[model samples]
Target: MDESNSRSHTEEIPEFVGPYKIEGPLGVGGMGRVYSARHKVLNIPVAIKVFFRDVNEKPASAKRFIQEARLAASIEHINLVRVMECGNDQDDHPYYVMEKMSSSILLEMKKNGNYSEREAIDIGESVARGMSVAHHHSIIHRDLKPDNIMVSVDGLYKVGDLGLAKLQDIENTSPGLTMTKTGLGTPHFMSPEQALDAAHADARADIFSLGASLYFMVTGKKPFEDEGVQAIINENYEKGGPDPGGLNSDLSAGFCQLVKKCMAYKPEERYQTMENVHQELIDLRHRFHDSVKPIHFDTCFDLAGTKKEEIERLMEQHAKAASDKPKKEPVNKLYIVIIVALLILLLFLLKYIAL
Candidate 1:
């Protein structure tokens, strides 16, 4: 939680923020509070992210809150959370309207321990496409993690908090002022360069985080883990991490290699752009599909049998059909002779007519 700088408060939550009637608090984080609300006029449900009163007092935090809205709004991609409106409330607290998502990727991870390789790849591709849009506009989502990746109501993974990483390291300098620090973003998913020098980190840093995220999704473990934050950072920045294939033996070599490339210690070695990562994931998916043979049911069976029993029977039938089918057979000599005789007779009759 980044609420270390937030001041304690006991005031009752507001019933409304402008035209939207506040339903309740959905989530509260270091950035601020996300409230579930509905527009009184349109009766449409929306999530409103509002800066804490203490956070709003700081100009630096306020600037970041506004920047997050602008940065997210600039990229009109389906895989990104849609920013509807942003401004200050009557009390001057910064707030932005966004489409209400069902939950965060973290929640999904908890509900279903580590997705299958294909599910992880599919989600990773969707997120990469979204980040590709941000990278194109020169905006790096310095903080890319499962928590920041939201699941839309429609089940699409949407990346949120695009520009808030810049403010994540803000320290409360005084009563109403905050100062940015050299370090920002989650330590678990930071690229080597990003962990070393966040201010200078580029799009490659996002690729590393995306890889780390996918690594977590498929393996159900972070790429690097330690009791101390510094220890984890050192491991990621220095030794990198273990081969994902070693942990998840079910993963193909190509998929494992692709993920390892993303977490490369050297930014230059990593995928140069989010587009490249996206394309690679797409290609990997294609390869995975091609490698697996589709099961074709030659005959429909009754539902009386168990699924496993039915599958076993189908396999047996397919194998018998494959083995019993003739590989080759000699052509009938009698048919060939009949064709030759007909041709000879037709030629003889034509010659006789000519004579």
Candidate 2:
């Protein structure tokens, strides 16, 4: 057998991609292989995804892949996965370099059935923030499943896998455009319109997928799910989802309403923007926390700005800029309130102690 044909899909990675040393295989899929690599001087860990070394691969496919990488590398949002660099190997196998994040995905977490209502809502909103950034750049994360969402060490999410996502303003929208014929994305998370007419899908498709993800987080199962992809598509075109409040008997009606709104059959009926979806999540989380009444907001903000790149970059690196800005004194309003309340209790205690 030919060595090329004999190589397993999960074969060991080469020593280097250009200059970066390929440490090992990270993951693999039908499209290509991802490897853990290291920048020689920078020592930065990056995940490099590469296509198969096939010279006869479709021109459009390769072109679209490269374009997506380039576009993704330029978009600088904290919530979205950052593409540090991109290039093609000697065999014309294109690859991208990206910061390697902690690889915990929501898909794996959903299996445990431990998602509280507030956590589900927060996940939905965090993902929406990333989606909004992509939408702003005229890009749609056509594949918005939990596997594509990674939570970093600092507990912030960075949306990954822009490989299948389409840029709306690109020339590929014109006639004779070649779309991914089969399995462009995960069937479980696709919107009805996307399942039916993928090309016609826009940002709204992402909103529906986010709803599906949230549904899984909330209910621990897919609504309108099926054993096969075709069946799933058919079910999606019809009505969708488990009866929210009825299933869990723990979800609030307001949160259920929001989920249903996100899963609207028509794009027009769903969330108009990701920002709106995010804001709803924010409000819902706050409401849930309010009922609990013992939130440690101080601890939450203790290591504040630890995960924010822009803040540290401008504030620390550029001393002049930080000096120019008026520094405001830190105020602990919550602690002050607590102290005042404690003082009132102490006064009552004094009278009781005296008696």
Candidate 3:
């Protein structure tokens, strides 16, 4: 079950975290509870994630969690969730303010039944751009799933829970972590490396997870067979993959090929980089957009306004450039005219003498 809707923090007493007023609980998790908070004075809404458990009690876990939060905060991109602030109050339990996503795509799709292939491709393109933007910022989402892909009301797509799985990466970071050296992840979504040995993981590991999500969108089914968490993870050790082509004829050959590359047993065999996968998705979007005629707004009026502004800016830039230059040589126009008249008379005198 999804956490966003099921969890609400409305009834909690002293409805505030830091400066933001906690209007309600957004959701709950094993580690913490998320709240819908509004800034006291600014009244800006933010998602406040309050750690319900004592992370300090689990030192490495705490560090990993903090690292994830810090790393996420450092990255500034449209698709990625933005971190606002982090601090603790009198209780000493910590919470951080972050960008609130409108809703999860997984929840929405499940609610609406499977989407048409065209819609799926469009969403895929948006998600790819978001991921590409993150990769450009040197931050891998680490955890890319349908639940993490959130869509805003006006068609803005955001990737949430950036590096949320980083908490599991902290071997030195958490002594009292989750009682395991290997990290934990939901079944069917875990990359083989993450499922077997986390140290073998890297950015492309996210590509694998993305492929799994893409497979789900197209087939309306998870990539791997549903099984116990341990059982599915054990299969990761064995390195098994689902047969994408067998299930859906609607799945394009290129799409399945990319998915196959993504779910490759060897990480090297997967997409070389996140950008590579993003490019493929982008190319696919272009083709799809081309096939389905797009609405291109004629900017005659808008373009005219834009051009006017641009010319004004250029004129300002020209003036600034002119002002920045040192004073030029003042060539007297009258003096030049006088010199020309003298030179003309001299030429006439020379011509008369030659005649």
Best by TM-score: 1
Please give the CA lDDT of all the candidate structures.
0.79, 0.74, 0.68
Each candidate: RMSD to true structure?
6.5, 14.7, 12.4
The superposed Cα distance between candidate 2 and the true structure at residue 295, in angstroms, equals 9.3
Candidate 2 per-residue lDDT over residues 217-279, each given as its tens digit: 767776664866678866755765435665687898878888888888778898888988989
Q: Please identify model 1 stretches exceeding 4 Å from their true place.
A: 1-11, 163-181, 298-355
Error of 3 at 269 (Å): 1.8
The 10-residue segment of model 2 with minimum total lDDT is 293-302
Candidate 1 Cα deviation (angstroms), residue 283:
1.0
Runs of candidate 3 exceeding 4 Å displacement? 1-14, 54-56, 136-138, 163-180, 233-245, 290-355
Clashing pairs in 1: none
Ranking by TM-score: 1, 2, 3
Q: How many residue pairs clash in each candidate?
A: 0, 0, 6
